[model samples]
Target: MSDKKALNFTNWDTTFDNGTSEDGSRNCVYMSESLDYKWVATSCVEKINFL
Candidate 1:
């Protein structure tokens, strides 16, 4: 639920660093479940139970 910078969903930014997302899907910022809760970029279309 952490974003690279302070951003609100109403005006969320879709920009990412040079190599931010592994799958090249930088739609939303979410915490990784299998990576010890590290922040990662994922597609906003995906349904995640956790926030």
Candidate 2:
């Protein structure tokens, strides 16, 4: 549930959605490539973004 910046990359920025997802099933946050890499909430468990 943490992010890259939390690991010491201060200059980096994370673009999150307006808020958590309305769908109760989607509780995880991920970078959306279709939305220009903005952080979007989803239930996906296969893809993992790393620093």
**lDDT top scorer:** 1
Q: Tell me the spans in candidate 1 whose CA falls farther than 4 Å from its real position.
A: 1-25
For every candidate, C-alpha RMSD to the true structure in Å? 9.4, 7.6
Q: Pick by TM-score: which candidate is best?
A: 1
Worst 10 residues of 2 by lDDT: 9-18
Candidate 1 TM-score, C-alpha based: 0.43
The TM-score of candidate 2 is: 0.34
Candidate lDDT scores, in order, read: 0.57, 0.54
Segments of candidate 2 deviating more than 4 angstroms: 1-23, 44-51
Residue-by-residue lDDT tens digits, candidate 1, 1-51: 355686544422334352445566666767655656556666676678873
Q: Which residue pairs does candidate 1 place in steric collision?
A: none
Candidate 1 at 5: error in angstroms? 13
